[model samples]
Target: MSRIPDLPGVISSDEIVASAEHLAGLQTDSGMIPWWPGGHCDAWNHVESAMALDVAGLHREAERAYEWLADIQRPDGSWHNYYLPDGDRDMAVEDDKVDTNVVAYIATGVWHHWKCTSDRSFVDNLWPTVERALDHVLSLRKDDGLVLWAVEADGTRRWDYALLTGSSSIQHALRCGAAVGLATGSPRPDWVDAADRMCSLIANEPLAFQPKTRWAMDWYYPVLTGAIEGEAAKIRLADGWPTFSMEGLGIRCVSDEPWITASETAEASLAYASIGEFATATDLLRWTRSHRCPDGSYLTGLVYPDKVVFPEGETSSYTAAAVVLAADAIAGASPGSDLFVRSSLRPS
Candidate 1:
């Protein structure tokens, strides 16, 4: 039987499967999972959805989603920031940008799928794609080891600053990439070294990246990515709790905003679980139920005082995906469950 995450009283295996089904229902015929029925797709969130599908035992659908990425990958191994459901570039101002974190995420998805299935042939097939993607990401790293946030569609002009959340995510991807390399007998020590440097920067040099302290992702991503762990991870979450968390309603998207997003809450839960704080993680995850829809989809955000959906009828595949991933992390039933919890995937 395919392993499915079951979080006991918090969430049943069947409910998690239903959530994946809801997300899968939003996927295009070409295997592209959009934010919603008519929404745009981004490489990062698309990979996130694919990971969730794997967690729910939707292996065929998950593999198909990865194939969609392989089909659309740009020559430079990066994808545009956004694509329409029909597989055309969105071409909006920032939509055409190539985000390093976005490109690096394929390694995470591929590594997670490999863990879920132990499919060495599948890893071999996708190895080149992950290699090219991370290679392109490493090429963009600055002298300080932090990567630039993004580049123009031409892949020539680049952003001057890096983002804490984005770079932290890239670090996690690098570790996942190294794990994939090791499994395929292609051992990428360089990728592992780069990931360690990035982790050091994230742990000690907060000023290395652009300050988006107001954003919930910036507050939790270091822990979520395992860039910060042990007592340090606990301290970080506690420090940000008052600012970003909203008691029973989930966490705010931005520190000052009354709007709470399910995605952020779910991911923060994973961060807590990574540090052995399962009770706290479960509480944060239980809060996400406030935004859950009847059909197993999650609302993007709910504005407090009114409890209105901020995007106005928005339920994103990524938000639901986050919930699935968090449940898996807590349940510890899938092979990929430790992908986020572990500080490193490298062989000891």
Candidate 2:
């Protein structure tokens, strides 16, 4: 079988060296991939870094990240957005997020690591953790098919409503859960319903989450899942492209005001590929990979600190997650695999 390669822009000798350097240089001593020296961690960032470690074949380092999540997961199957270097809580949100989606993200992480390394122990060990977390996340779903925004880390409720990004994110995670459920020999009807309900909200209703903003993440993610597919997705995607996209740089998390966002662009590129816009997707990925360091890590955002300023530094997790998902779509392993050039997931 002809397998896909790891890391985008990694072809020539120099590119290979750069990827190796980027991968090795990006690691922290604690084995938990930090976004930046003094930065906080979120579910998205953690999962992104773990996938990046998988791309680099740093399985142990990657496994540690999954463990980091397992250790810190709240009793109610969610994670706080921030954690201090000592593995203690740092900045706590006023209300805890019912991070069922993020909690379910580990299924993708474990599955990706298993495919890359074929490590059965890693997959088998986390079965219960995955099971219980999904159980709790599923507990909060509403009759209209919306999941709650979040709960307190201590299991208190956070909000009575749902956020668009949060709902979109969890929808993807629920699909990941289905995949995990299939893998573990214990599939749940609730998970399938969660995926189907989230899809219905995305496809059938406009007011699924918060009103649709021009954030590129919001634009393309529905396509990444089976939530929005085919030509309708293309229109929904292109409709918002001009508002936030720069021809070469990336996207802004929101439209109208604020600065551009690299993480959003990278992920949006993956979403674009889901709809088969290979040219646009690769261009964004190339611009992103071009900005990468010799060590294979990438800066988190662009136009930060101030909109006029250049991006600061490696949100290895962000870049890593983008790379993996984009690559997955490209390589045809992902549900929306029709997006990539080959089956490499590296659309560019």
Candidate 3:
């Protein structure tokens, strides 16, 4: 990966590197990056952290992170929602819900690493992991094209509803998976079909996804995942601006809530950049600086007005990862930054 250049008024490249190093320091010897020391790790957030590592030129650590994921993957291609850093089960959350988005994200992470480093060997080795992960995720697809959010511990799909953010994110993952298939001479036309269908569902049928409109992610995730674009994306951002955004503190976690989170703010910036709104993206990124700690790590979010850290003052590796990704997008630092803006798979 090329060196990330400094963005003078927003974040310096040195600070970006320092943030990445902070995340790297959090990774356990087993390669898992928990939310914090003694905290649990989830597959989705773990991949996000690994992608940040790749963007920061920590290729070896990124590879090890993926290898750790590969080592622990369930035979059915699913992972429990959370785990201890030492590869042990996180028993605190008794619910063993296997999240579709968490499983599907490996494809995005694998494809991202390949894009940043051009490591064909890494992609080839990880191809099976991606293939199986997608297989599990696609199996959760309902007839209407929305992927069910999770599989219960009973091995049944959570058919009650799908999430707009999760389904939108899965669409991007499917496209990345298809791209991996094509690059490796392993074409997955089924994944392409699923992606096209999912995009249509996200673009045309908001009602199909469960009503989580109260959350900020529901507003911008479709655009961030490339399901919504062009003028539609601009309109989406405009529609939710008054409800979700605060002037300088960052994006609120919920419209009615006072909490502003680093991960959501960073992701919102990506949504803006995906639509060619670089200035707005930069402005949003500047808000993220307030969430940064003296050591270059980011707080998960803050409760506004009171101006206190949320979740009892946790600073998460995933939150740090989100900031790194937003910086990369704004600076055009890595090929992976284009993952959110690129078109979906074309049928062969």
Which numbered prediction scores highest in lDDT against the true structure?
1
Instruction: Give the true-structure RMSD of model 2.
Output: 4.3
Per-residue lDDT over 239-316 for candidate 3, one digit per residue giving the tens place of the 0 to 100 score: 999999999889999999889998999999989888877788889999998889987798988997988888877899
- In order of appearance, the predictions have TM-scores of 0.95, 0.81, 0.95
Q: Tens digit of lDDT per residue, candidate 2, span 1-348? A: 213333345223344334433544544554444556544566556766676555545567778777766766666666665554553433334324445556666665665666666566777677666766767777877778887766666666666676666676676666666666666676766777777887778787877576667566667777765478778878887787788787666777677654655567677867776667767776666656544555555566566434353444435446645655565444443323332222443334
Ranking of all candidate structures by their lDDT, best first:
1, 3, 2
lDDT by residue (89-193, candidate 1, tens digit) is: 332323788999999999999999998999888889899999999999999989998899999989775688889999889988998999999999999999989
Return the TM-score for candidate 3, rounded to 2 decimals. Answer: 0.95
RMSD of 3: 3.4
Ranking by TM-score: 1, 3, 2
Task: Give lDDT for model 1.
Answer: 0.88
| Residue 69 shift from truth in candidate 1, angstroms | 0.7
lDDT of 1 at 164: 93
List candidate 3 stretches off by more than 4 Å: 87-95, 342-348
Off by over 4 Å in 1: 87-94, 343-348
In angstroms, give how far residue 207 of model 1 lies from its true place: 1.3
* Number of clashing pairs per prediction, in order: 0, 18, 0
